[model samples]
Target: MRKYIITGLLVWLPLAITIWVLLWVLGIIDGVFVWLLSAVQAVLPDSARASIRELHNIPGLGVLVLVAALMLTGMFVANMFGQWWFRQWDRLLFKIPIVKSIYSSVKQVSDTLFSSSGNAFREAVLVPYPHPQSWTIAFVTGKPAGEVGDQLATLSGAASEEHVSLYVPTTPNPTSGFFLMMPRSQLRPLAMSVDEALKYIISMGVVAPASDALSAHPAKQPAAAESARN
Candidate 1:
């Protein structure tokens, strides 16, 4: 009886959680649609409002509306005039003192994450952290830029050597992490893709990428050769 019950739960638990999550998200989106409908109905004649009362209860309407709005925005932003307007809008945002700082930082991060040509998170790496011989998986964001790179070079007395920026995400919650800048020679590049590494991290190493995959991608190369190739 115990085995049967455990097996049944194993089969059903994931399905139940997934359904619950989907329903919860749908309910929240539907609430937005309901609020918007109520606002519009406030100014409408009673008879007209009554005629459209059924629309207020429609599930997933807000999701549809949100998708449509995003599509329209994308279409609008694809043109020359739209690009000019966007630049002007960005300028206006930059004029605000506090808002500009927050907005600019977020925009830069989003651009790097979403840009097609961006190199952020392109490779997975391993580096010693907290102590020697203890290593953690990290994502290579890019090379350190501007003053940070210069300062690191000066401190290390290796102005000619390149330093790469990495994010070492914590297990189970990959969103929060430490940002590190280390010389390229120290990082051990891994064969795993960003998605595969993420899965390993999020699963707390229980789910690992295949070792065979690493065979095709060498983890280490001579620093001199790497610098020369780059």
Candidate 2:
């Protein structure tokens, strides 16, 4: 009976969790849309409210609208006039005292992450952090070009005039992290794919690569060491 129950759990657990998560997300988005519609309905004509209600009743229309809005925004930013307008708008926002603080902060974050020329999360990398033997996942954002890299190289007495800025992201949540500027040679490349590395990190060392697993488990070590010696 216990064996049967365990097998059942293994089969059903993932599906159950996936369904619950999807339902929860849909519920939250639906709630937000309903609230916004209600707010607008107060000012809308009774005939218009009928159309709004009909639109809301169509499943997944809210998500479609959100996707369409994002696509439209991308299209707007692609053109010459939009680029000029964006700069002008940014200048105007900068002149406003209180708004400048908030606007600049948000703009910096968006530009760093989303701009085509900007170098955040450009290349995946591996970095040793906290300790020499210990390592963490990182991304190679951009090579330090212009005066910054040159000044650093001169100050450090480096033979090469190159430096790079790397963005190190924490697992389970990839949004927040520290940025480090280091010499290119110091960074090591990992054999595992990004998804595999993420799974290992998020599991907090419980999940390991096949090579690592062989080294860790006692039963496998003697054979592995013998093979290495040969």
Candidate 3:
């Protein structure tokens, strides 16, 4: 009886969690629609407000509106005029001191993550962490550039070869973790895609990447002995 109950839980737990998360997100987005509806009600004639109230009761309407708004914004931003306007708007935002720092940092990260030409988090890799004989999954964010690259090279005692910047995201929350700089040669590059590696990390190794997907470059196996102790 216990075994059967455990098996059922194993099957349903993920589904339950997934549904809960979707509903949570939906509720947040729906709040925006609720605010907009309230504003419209304040401005509209009584008859029009009555019609709008009926539509407000429709479930998932906010999601559709939000998605449509995003799509429209994307389309609007794909042109030269939009590009110029965006630059102007960005400059305006940057003049606001406190907002400038927060917005710019977030914008840079978003651009790196979402830009078509960007290579951030494109490759997954394996590196030794904490101490030797232990390994962790990491994402190859990019090659360290300019002053950062030079400083890292000096610190690593290998100024000639390039160093890579990696992000080692924590399990379950994958949002917070360490950023590492290491030599390309010293790191073992993994064959797993960014998505696969993310699943592995978020699941805390419970969701392993495919066996054949575990290939490493330069060195066929991870070299825990040679891993940088930084």
Candidate 4:
């Protein structure tokens, strides 16, 4: 019973934290979203005002704004001038002792998880979740591409297997979760189809996949690992 409670905590706590962090980031973006709406109303020509008003009245505007911001940021960085300015800005942050630690760490991680390339979210895997003592399911999103791949290699002593980008989905709702990247060697590969993994995860281990693949391997009982000792 004690172990069950502990495991349950391990599962739900990370999900809660991931959700809280997501909401926090969205909250910040939402503020910007609102500000942009007001700016659009104030600055646009009379002919554009009605469309701006319509946009302001609609739902999910914040999500749209957030998407637009990311798209614009990506577009900016892709150009040569934008790339030059980005490097300068990046270097300036790196020069700051405390800021560099946070900035670079976030940059490397974001690059690995979010960089657009390769086949993202193609496979399901099992790994220690929240901590190594417990386990959960994740999807193989993609690998680090281009310069991000180089950065990952430099982190290790020598050239090594590329880190696999992953999306660790939450229980009950498989959509929202954490993004991760770890060495391919460290992963405990699972044979379960990605769809099967999603069903198992969404059910919180209640609806197991109708396959003996997981059961046949006693040692690699990843689905069972999320059972919280039942």
Per-model TM-score on C-alpha atoms = 0.84, 0.71, 0.88, 0.44
What is the lDDT of every predicted structure here? 0.87, 0.74, 0.84, 0.80
lDDT of 4 by residue, 69-173 (tens): 889998999999999999999989999999999999999757755666535555678877788799888888777778978888889553766688888988798
Highest TM-score against the true fold, candidate: 3
Task: Output candidate 4 Cα RMSD.
Answer: 11.1
Residue 9 lDDT in model 4?
A: 100
TM-score of 1: 0.84
Name model 4 segments beyond 4 Å from true: 1-29, 35-59, 116-188, 193-199, 210-230
Clashes of 1: 0
Best by lDDT: 1
> Cα deviation in Å at residue 154, candidate 1?
2.2
| lDDT of candidate 1 over 1-230, digit per residue (tens) | 99999999989998999999999998988888888888998999988998668887677888999899999988999999999999999999999999999999999999998888999998998899967689999999998879887788887568788889999999899999999988888887777888989999998999999876654554544366467778
95-129 in candidate 3: lDDT tens per residue?
99999999999999999999889899888888888
Poorest 10 consecutive residues of model 4 by lDDT? 112-121
Query: Given candidate 4, what's the lDDT at residue 30?
Result: 69
Model 2: per-residue Cα lDDT over 1-230, one tens digit each = 99999999989998999999988887777777777878888799998898777766766666666788889987997899888888898899999999999999998878887888876755556677856798787777777767877677786557564667887777667667788887777777554545556667767656776666434444424454667868
Instruction: Report how far off residue 42 is in candidate 2 (Å).
Output: 2.3
Could you give the C-alpha RMSD of every candidate to the true structure, in order shown? 4.3, 6.9, 5.1, 11.1
- True lDDT of residue 41, candidate 3: 92
What's the CA error at residue 70 for candidate 2, in Å?
A: 1.7
Give the runs in model 1 whose Cα sits over 4 Å from its true position.
43-48, 215-230
